[model samples]
Target: MAAIALSVSTVKPLGDRVFIKVSESEEKTTGGIFLPDSAKEKPQVGEIVAVGPGKRHDNGTIHTIDVAIGDKVLYSKYAGTDIKLGTEEYVLLSEKDILAIVS
Candidate 1:
């Protein structure tokens, strides 16, 4: 099978979906102990990179997504599909999967 190249600029979500750049996981503990890659947990926080257009309602109205690109947001763990572009990690999630917008 032929492999297709993907870049952050090339990926776009359909409806009410968002693309987020995953934050780097902490490499050290408070006690100054370093963590191995196997010990690091997936970070639940990320910055929004791309967003889909508003979802269409049955009445033909659109409910726009509240979050915008560059907004830091906390999302549900295990939510969304994980995507890797080069060395950066990202996730594609529905707007509903986002828990809160971090200040």
Candidate 2:
């Protein structure tokens, strides 16, 4: 059996979910002080690289997700599932995890 390599140019969530590439924060402070690896704060914002189709209601209606790909967004500090693409790390989260979309 051959292993398949998946190259995702656009990620689409199936339902009320979104895919995000979590941006790593700068390690050095503005004052030029380098924070230790353990002291670095977790990034709360990321760019939306992929989005789910929409949310399904009990009434059989679909509620569309607001965020689109390439949009920047803010999320909870502990939300999302971590994934690795090539050499980069990313996050897979539900639409509810997205707190706000930044301009």
* Residue-level lDDT tens digits of model 1 in 1-103: 9999999999998899999999999999999999999999999999999999979999999899999999999999999999999999999999999999999
Q: Candidate 1: minimum summed lDDT over ten consecutive residues — where?
A: 53-62
Tens-digit lDDT track of model 2 for 5-82: 644564556889988888888789999999998999878889988888799999999999998889999999899887
Q: Best candidate per lDDT, number?
A: 1
In order of listing, the candidates' clash counts read 0, 2
- Superposed on all Cα atoms, model 2 deviates from the true structure by an RMSD in Å of 1.9
TM-score of 2: 0.85
